[model samples]
Target chain A: MTTYKRMVLASRPQGHVVPENFRLEEVPVPDLKDGELLVRNHYLSLDPYMRMRMEDVKSYAAPQAIGETMIGGTVGEVVASKNPKFAVGDKVQGMFGWSEMGVSDGSLLRRLDTTHIPLSAYLGSVGMPGMTAWYGLTQIIQPKEGETIVVSAASGAVGSVVGQLAKLRGCRAVGIAGGKEKCDYVVNELGFDACIDYKAGNLKEELAKATPNGIDGVFENVGGEIFDACLERMNPFGRIALCGMIAGYDGDPSPIRNARFFLTMRLSMRGFIVSEHMDLWPQGLKELGTLVATGKLKFRESVAQGLEAAPEAFIGMLKGRNFGKQLVKLI
Target chain B: MTTYKRMVLASRPQGHVVPENFRLEEVPVPDLKDGELLVRNHYLSLDPYMRMRMEDVKSYAAPQAIGETMIGGTVGEVVASKNPKFAVGDKVQGMFGWSEMGVSDGSLLRRLDTTHIPLSAYLGSVGMPGMTAWYGLTQIIQPKEGETIVVSAASGAVGSVVGQLAKLRGCRAVGIAGGKEKCDYVVNELGFDACIDYKAGNLKEELAKATPNGIDGVFENVGGEIFDACLERMNPFGRIALCGMIAGYDGDPSPIRNARFFLTMRLSMRGFIVSEHMDLWPQGLKELGTLVATGKLKFRESVAQGLEAAPEAFIGMLKGRNFGKQLVKLI
Candidate 1:
């Protein structure tokens, strides 16, 4: 209880991330000070955005400082508390990095009621990922009834919710995933109208077939050739909510070959970070929580055991190895 | 005067357009029917958008059919009239294609007043090109008072007005053009804050120096390495009004290499054709007309002498040979 394990960014990745990029160390958990609470982290969220922060470049936020705790979202319970506002047994969500325990001042911590939703759901469906999907779909894409929407990385945390929300709005939802397994799960379990397996090597043809009426809205997560394929079939005046480009996490961005479509189709594309739009988080979270609690929106997770496995999990997630929302489970 | 000269699409260009792609033909003028009027074309607009319609590809509009008079905008005088709405010697604007004379049913004809504004200005500053610049700058880029806006092809019809309009809105306007002459015109004549000569072989560095604050808004007319250079220095939440990609007129679009910036900077990019938004035209044209009429907006023209010179002028315009609004004066 006095000591816990955590991972720190040892070095920035050259091209692709490797195990050596992260260093795991056992450290003493700090004692809670006045107006402070100690959180024993349960699960850490591994997202593509962290890779962006790892780079020593100008981005939306400052780069993740080298040799510092790797930034992440964690869902856990308060083990010790001195603040009157927080109880010791209360479950909470905070950006506590990739660590087994963290000390916070309750300023950034959100108390979680895990009666209907599970604690891990805070890191996936009802947390930042869910809010990202909701904001992009509702605000950017704005799909109308009977319109067709294409969701890239359909099995990932953010994209899973985007398709579900699009379907809820009475739009035809199509998903683009990596393999046959993920594609089947997207269509059969997640209720997408159609799913294109990008790894099948016929992405352009399959995507065109899936989107016969052309894509009205796109919730793009994995940008590369996959995105180019989507752009080729985009309907006139289509809206693209560019959430992530996991394909470019290695510092080199994939070129958009179908740039002509942007002009010819008169498309509107906007890239956004969910944290920047906090005003809509409450509304988005409420809807996402309801769907997850009612079993209407199903989400799958791939959890790697212990803090030491985070680096590999994150690297694998970037390469499309992870089946769903990648998380590090710290017990 | 019974027979008038017109240019028609002879063949589709493979990669680059040549004079052989167009054929000049002399045809007898048709007698006007009831409610129809005859227009003696004075000026024909030659624009980059015409190059797009030359290819038989899927675009916002249909391809320019072979052996048909090439699509264009013209300002002319009503030579004869059967419609009560028109009269002899009345100056008018219409989509009369690349012809010395045209017959209109008065449906598409717009009466023009040459009191303060010249007839030729209707095809440049107060015409489709001007409206295009207005829509992209005001509706899409939406530059703030202190924001920095960059215009490409800065001496061309659309770009010349884009910079001038941006300046009128109190924005810092930067321009990118091919030669010293166009660059000088963009800065000294058009009132852009700075102009980068892309042909100088140091576009990236020159653009960086010109836009020290980074680009907040981009009025993109030429999409190639120049557009890529602008994307590199775009500020956070930058907006790009993708108006044209003249570099891609040969059918191959240039790829966007800095696609990662789209996400990291949280930018908004929209590709638009001005003609599609008919609702905003009247308001936009009124403002543009006032600017030109009051001498607040100034323009330049690269005029070809006659209808037979259009094909070569258009080819030259595509290669950045035209200094300003390229037009063919068929008197």
Candidate 2:
């Protein structure tokens, strides 16, 4: 057996998570059983929904208790295999948590074939976040031709895919992000028609200019003042896919001021958990993979150095610090 | 041609419509042309949409012009006909406006065959208001069985029908009205499971008691602070049909609190004008009329005497003073 470092939740956060909320512990790795396989973590993905799980509130996902390892998705390589489905040196993606090495029973894991794409892409462009954007835009919102779509957190994992998909459907895609840098990245790299900086002054005016014909669809990720501003700009038959309200995950609830929601705008807003649409993942990945291979879709990643930097990376990502998919390199 | 007394818009009110906003004038009776019928108004249905038409702001319908007669739905008798399709005594319902007599070209009118129901029933139970409830419940909200539904302005024309239809579908129906009298009318006459009076204290507590499993469907007619209270008790997958915001119709733009709209609840809220669903009106009216004739549904009308009392009836209906469908008796 070998020893590996794992970060556990030390305390629950009140407003924003700090480095002190996580504790690094050294533990000996377990031996693989009859049905289990031993794996070494290669890349760990940090997402916004993790912040929601940190709080002790009723949510779609279970809350991460103190003294438990922080839950996340990880791309890893099998070091030893006892299961027939996986072999040694097989790259896999699973819910391996925040650890350098772990043993899995192949229950929540998928072995990736290297002939398809890079193993790291399994934690990104063809991953859960990517499928979320695909199913939400294609099935839920179902944007028609000549419609205008607005997406929040447009430079992140899910939002980037949503913008590209909107553009592919012959609709004008507008992105809203925090800083000018991410806004530029969304417009220049992701092929979004326009981008708005929510950190700048006058969100309503900016949204009015970005969506002159009024918003036909909104891919809502960040909820707060931005959500309210988008609500005001929705047309008569607008559709909204409620992906994530990251701005309210930290618990300081922002006031919503759209009184005319019951009259002026006709909206169909639906909150979606990715697990409910898991059955379509294989098909979604295949289509998204084709888009990526043909240069129709693009993705970027901001990698943190080691497991020790996971806490800071998560905090920075929440504060709009990362440029793309925030990941921690565990090798 | 003979002359008739008609009510015309003299001036637009700054806040609420009064006697001065309307003027009684004697005008030359309209002459019937080809495919035309001369109708003598027997009953005029005063509605809340007239308040919206009085303002110069853009809405679903055009604003009532100064010196032009106020537009409304009326059940009238065909006094003369230019074509052979109709006799002199045929009862019909049309967009005849606030007048004792008018000419119709068979456009925007429906002949009311009163063999199955009363003539006044066309103005109340099986006409525009009835169709509004049917389409709002069936097409817009689409409430399923075993769901808790709530309706505001519960004793009014549209809401009473909505509550009864909900009950017929095996769903628990709760209502919000103005006073104890209307609350009694909503519960006893309309067969709503429970009723809450907005004038009563502790609206939130009363709502919690009325909707123990949370509100799955909300048919909103009155919007204001009452809308805020209902937002708190909405379930995960709630549907709200924005029929009318009577509480905000007087141009009192107050901030509505809607913080719970995005995070946990999935709401499909859509505003609709009844005319938008005209293609399906025959099916809806047939179904609703069958329900009423077979004793499965019940309705009540609060009739005020004379054409000059239309403004007072409208103002009273806006303040929740009427018991049921507010109508003006012209004959």
- In terms of TM-score, which candidate is strongest? 1
Q: Which ten residues in a row have the lowest lDDT in candidate 1 chain B?
A: B248-257
Tens-place lDDT digits, model 2, residues A142-199: 9999999999999999999999999999999999998899999999989999999988
Error of 2 at B28 (Å): 3.0
After superposition, which runs of candidate 1 have C-alpha atoms over 4 Å from their true positions?
none
lDDT of 1: 0.93
DockQ of each: 0.89, 0.42
Evaluate candidate 1 and give its CAPRI docking class based on DockQ.
high
Q: List A-chain TM-scores for all predictions.
A: 0.99, 0.97
Off by over 4 Å in 2: A1-3, A10-12, A16-28, A114-116, A254-256, A259-262, B8-26, B54-58, B64-67, B253-263
Return the top candidate by DockQ: 1
Query: lDDT of all predictions, in order shown?
Result: 0.93, 0.85
| Candidate with maximal lDDT | 1
Candidate 1 interface RMSD to the true structure: 0.7
Report lDDT (Cα) of residue A187, candidate 1: 95
